[model samples]
Target: MALSEQGRHALRHPPRWHWLLLLLILPIVAVSLLFEGWTTHEVDGARTRRACTSPIPRSADNGAPVLRVTGAGAETVQMPLRTAALTFDGGPDPVWTPRILDLLRARHAHATFFLYGTQAARHPDLVRRIHDEGHEIGSYTYTGGDLGSASAVRSQLELSLTQTALAGAASVNTRLLRLPHTTTADTMCGGEWSAARRASDDGYLLVAATARSRKPPLGVVRQYSHSALGYQEATKLLDDPEVGRFTTVTSGLGRPSLTAPASLLQRLQGNALIWTQSLGHRFARSMTWALGIAGGLGILRLVLLACLARVHVRRQRRHRSGAPWLREVNDPVTVLVPAHNEEAGVEATLRSLLASTHRDLQIIVIDDGSTDRTAEIARGVGDPRVTVVQQPNSGKPGALGTGLSYARCDIIVMIDADTVFEPDALHRLIQPLADPTIGAVSGNTKVGNRSRLLGRWQHLEYVLGFNLDRRMFEVLECMPTVPGAIGAFRRDALTAIGGISDDTLAEDTDLTMALWRVGRRVVYEERAVAWTEVPSTFSQLWRQRYRWCYGTLQSMWKHRHAVFEVGPAGRFGRRGLTYLALFQIVLPLFAPVVDVFALYGVCFGDTGQAVGVWLAFLAVQLVTAAYALRLDHERLRDLWALPLQLFVYRQLLYLVVIQSVVTALLGTRLKWHRMHRSGTANQHLLREPAPQPSGLASK
Candidate 1:
């Protein structure tokens, strides 16, 4: 079976030209149709009309002046009409429809009301009244079918037309159409050219909603402070007479010119890649675009994030540099430790609590009827400062609640039995509670033994994620959670919020919000660090994080009423709630898709050189990790793991998020699953187990 060296060489080293040939021919082959001279004029499935070489000039009558403007890569014009048309959609309801008709009639206007088929069928008298009043009655749609798909758009359009024709003989020749919800382009209007051609072919002219379109529920349109600048620009454009020419609302009236470039961009163009690509085209383009845009956006984003990280580091440094917070709290504190099946670590945790530099701390251990000798070990700690309470297992929240009820101090600190606190952790944790305005303080949690790759990753997460970001949230007075692992609270603050509820999975987040509602200040103390066991196996990590995410969502749902409150925090509460939704929920859901598109750009888009895109994206991830590492003092080599982590590992988060969301929607329960720990920080510590001395052995 031995082959000659020459034969082996021939098999191993093939010609490089084969690779070069593919690289040269792909782009030209892919975009050949776009280069074809054929100009698509109309769409068949959806009613659409492309801006095809400007419509033929129509005669102006009834003392109407022709208005026109062209500048800055755009053109606008207005035509006159003998009659004004107003369209009202989405009701025959008592709340809105009748009032809308009175308003239109007051303006001496004739409107074309597009009724929902179901609502119209139910309100036959209302439909007749619209026709009876000389207003042109129409249909919104039969079932709110999207006007993006050819068949769906055609069917919906015809159904609406049929319903309108039934209302009156004059309505049979109606050509005006509107899309439901307006955010239909990416999903239904895949190819603009094709959709336009289809709609025009069906003798329909698409009408776009203007800024004056129906406001969202509760007049919240005015409350959209996040995009206020953009809205203000849009609002100003709505008032301009020439801007009305490009707008459907003033198509027949002479109006002011449109100003905002962004408004124009959104109205005129659709994302060709997102909407019109075949699966093959998508696969080829996804990498190129994903790597390019994500690379660019991710770079600027990381730069800003790095600055924030710096701010966090500086704050932590200042806190550590100045007098420690714990020096102020001289009163004896009640430290509550909730233990369940924790015989392995409960003793060590108790020992650490007894060793606290603050001599005024008393430890309260609640042993929730563990199957093991957890209660006996806790009692055997023999510290006069410790009080052991035994109760049947009712979960961690229930156990914590029971201990809290019996706590004798104004300041109460909750620490997990598995967590070994730093000598100063308890002192530093309670320092913030001394401030009359402060309600709670959260301690930083670090990984006890980060030897495995998974553990190291978790370590990185704690340093950069849990520790750093939380400081920023605290500065904004919107700290999302005071972690159960090592958190201290003012007893009055807890009592004001009616104590922690065990209904939701994440009692910590729920409690945090309750504190905020009462206007209690929560602070993060970096010096108050505890080393605790983290999930070592991938599956354990998945389950732990899934519960965390699900619990977060559950708590959010349970406390949604606090979002717009004029409570103690007021504006801070509103902003904090907005940040929670934007970053935690929305960004996690969208970031994966954004990454996919960046990859598409790297593989197929016009990102100059392919290697350039690759390098840019690599630089962003590296820069982000570098700053993140610097802020937390993690190893620099951790940055190198980002690409691999993103490719092979980060996607697991998306799956967990999806699963958690689905489970929540379906009303599923998930109890916290603890991971196994080696019970030692180093391999040498594991050489011999801790000696079972006689004083700690008896129940």
Candidate 2:
């Protein structure tokens, strides 16, 4: 099958896996949320407080019972005078570990190195090098999470995974372990004591740091990190004469040690842990990169929208000021209204067209197999200029093609069945056709049924998102879609593109792109305004947007070859298609992940940073939306719905894009979705008189 056919098939019968993929994401998010919440409650909060203020409890003689657990679960161990043990915790760092190792090598000192499984797995060579260099290896746990606060499973996994990494890296496992966040043997208290006892039961020896003093203490196991600062601190101890001998904990204790070879099963488990940890690390890195890309693209789009909107405003002002120099096209025109089960708004649409300021018009309403009285309503208008044509069901594109066939004028204006036009809308819509280079013109479309929150949210989107985007597209000379709600095209342009194609669901977009490919300019005429009723509920809105998004994908794919063409087609293909793919399709797909990351930050990471970034992005949107509303002569109060819209309405739109892309990829075909209209378009227009064009004469 051809690529287009494949796309159609994907839309019609989307593979089950497509939905499964989306469903899978939900469980992942839920798991992440649960994990993050648990971590925050059990570890993160306490950890933060401990970092700010010492968490280790003090005991008499500066020996904390809860800080350390030896083989016998002893709070403190008595060592021979003039002997000191050096221990390093928290890493097998690629950079710092090597430097520390070099320092230790220069001093000919061997210390116990407590390795985090995650870091050890990531830098297994370092782990092996530490062991090979005659240093004692011990477990610092998998993620260096505090075993004191960890669940039983987490504590076991932490220690076992570290052992697994050790066994995989060096084919040997050690009994020595270290409790994370504990400073000295005397510092272990409450939960730390309990955790130490548990490790002792598992046949692991626990090591902790001795208290720091002006004079180095002999026979004390001093812990340090594998970092530059730790190396500096350890240098002081190595240089101290009081610390007579620097050796491993077991050596200092006069215990003979032997490297035990790992069992095959142990090695296998270790390697598996290493693989899983590595995969998690890679996934985290990928998400970080994705977040950056998504954020950058989103910001770039906003900046472009704002800048291009200013350019559009300036250009429009220049045109308005020099209106006398503008050529007025007063040629006879044909208006096509393709209706399908649109009995609710067809009469109002016909009445609005009859009220156009331009005198000459041939209005044709093509009823495409409507089960309602849409045709009857159009014919009942009883106007000479209005003609109703009945046709069998063939979809919007086919009905539009039929209307185009009966068009008698050089210019054809197309409006949706649910749209109500202003008195001067038709006149302003056609004025752009006076330019021979301009093949088609897109008009300003506004949401009519905006009383409810959903409608109000969509209203803001129309003025802020769609209309502002059209202005930018016009300034760039890469207008991708002349909206079906209100657009005008030269009849020659329509004929050149073979009337209207039913190949793609979005006929208007497809035709607009075709016009651009043929080297004809498509411009936006903001003065030509039409009010159209939007979906009233979430479900209805979702279906409408799904069809729109899918249709747009089909159109873009159909014009894929234009990217390699010369001149205008290449420009439109590269600039227009690239913009659409990035800002529309790609960003929306990644937005859910961004939201998930933000939620994670709030739960387990830095809540302030996450909220700050989100607020900054929202601020940029608010400014842009405000400017867009200003340009469209809409009230700023509508922006109150925008923030709330971001939470729910925005997500719904993203889901629509996701579903559409999935459908397109799976080669499922989708039937056209028709909204159930309530004639809200007429109600809105009747609520207030339509604004007339300034300094323009009505025919």
Which model scores highest in lDDT? 2
Off by over 4 Å in 1: 1-301, 312-327, 606-618, 633-637, 677-699
Candidate with maximal TM-score? 2
> In order, what is each prediction's RMSD in angstroms?
20.7, 4.3
Q: After superposition, how far is residue 420 of candidate 2 from its true place, in Å?
A: 0.7
lDDT per residue, candidate 2, 397-458, as tens digits? 88898998899999999999999988889998888787798899999998888889999999
State the displacement of the C-alpha of residue 234, model 2, in Å, after optimal TM-score superposition.
4.6
Per-model C-alpha lDDT, please? 0.57, 0.79
lDDT value, candidate 1, whole model: 0.57
For 390-441, candidate 1 gives per-residue lDDT tens digits of 9997877888899998888998998888888767778777877767888999
